[model samples]
Target: MSTTQNERLRGLLEPLVGAQGLDLEEIEVSQAGRRRVLRVVVDSDAGVDLDTVADVSRAISAKLDETDAMGEGEYVLEVGSPGADRPLTEHRHYVRATGRLAKLQLHEGGELVARILTVDDEGLDLEVPGVKGRKPTARRVGFGDIAKARVEVEFNRKNKQDELEQEEEEA
Candidate 1:
């Protein structure tokens, strides 16, 4: 699609998505076989559930049907949330990722894999694990120092609070 048309689509759909308390993260139109596919990525601070995604999809489809935004061709509308591996671009993205492990690419050099402790307007506070079983050290990384960041999947992660609750339940 043309840039103007994409901008127009963004203008029209952003408000509709925002009305449901979600941000329109992306809009992409591509060809699939003989039909066009329109993919819309939506997200929120609290994250999006399956039902919420369905609701947004219906709203977006209806809005498109009511206009010539998709032109005369048949287009498939796919509205969904960003995956866990989505790049952390906006500050709100970092804020929403609090408590998650992130691998940040530093602007200066090197990469840092740390668990996010807190996020503020200035930067993020991370817990960088020390060598072996040593105590994890807290590190403050300014946003300006980050080139790119993505959430890392943690397997076999055990939460002490959760373990305690389970033990109490068993007791």
Candidate 2:
């Protein structure tokens, strides 16, 4: 899509999305075979569910139907949340990622995978796991120091229930 079209779409959809209590993370229009695809990524600190996505999709579809913003082309609308691996580009992203593991690349030069402990206006407090069974260390990283960051998926991470059960067993 053209830059102007994209901007127009953003302007048209952002208010709709905000009204529904979701942040408009992205808007993309792409070609897939003979049809165009419009993908809208929405998110919130509390996370997004399928039902919310469905509602948002219906609203977006209706809004598009009521307007010529799409320029008369057949397009499929896909509304969803950002995947677990989506890059953390905003402070709110980091805030929502609290207690999750993230791989951060520093602007000055290094990279590290750490669990996000807390997020404030200026930076993040991370717990960098140590090597060879060593204790994790606390580190502070300002938002500006991060060149890039993304949540890391952990298949074996224990949930709160599992941890609670383990503690009960030990007790």
Winning candidate number (lDDT): 2
Q: Which ten residues in a row have the lowest lDDT in candidate 2?
A: 69-78
- What stretches of model 2 exceed 4 Å from their correct place? 167-171
Q: Once model 1 is optimally superposed onto the true structure by TM-score, how far is the C-alpha of residue 149 displaced, in angstroms?
A: 0.5
| Per-residue alpha-carbon lDDT of candidate 2 for residues 12-39, written as tens digits (9 for 90 to 100) | 9999999999999999999999899999
Q: lDDT score, residue 130, model 2?
A: 94
Find the candidate with the highest TM-score and give its number.
2
Q: State the TM-score for model 2.
A: 0.94
What lDDT is reached at residue 11 by model 1? 100
Model 1, runs deviating above 4 Å: 163-171
In lDDT terms, how accurate is model 2? 0.96
Residue 30, model 2: Cα distance from true site in angstroms = 0.5
Candidate 1 residue lDDT tens string, 7-111:
999999999999999999999999999899999999999999999999999999899999999999888999889997889999899989998899999999999
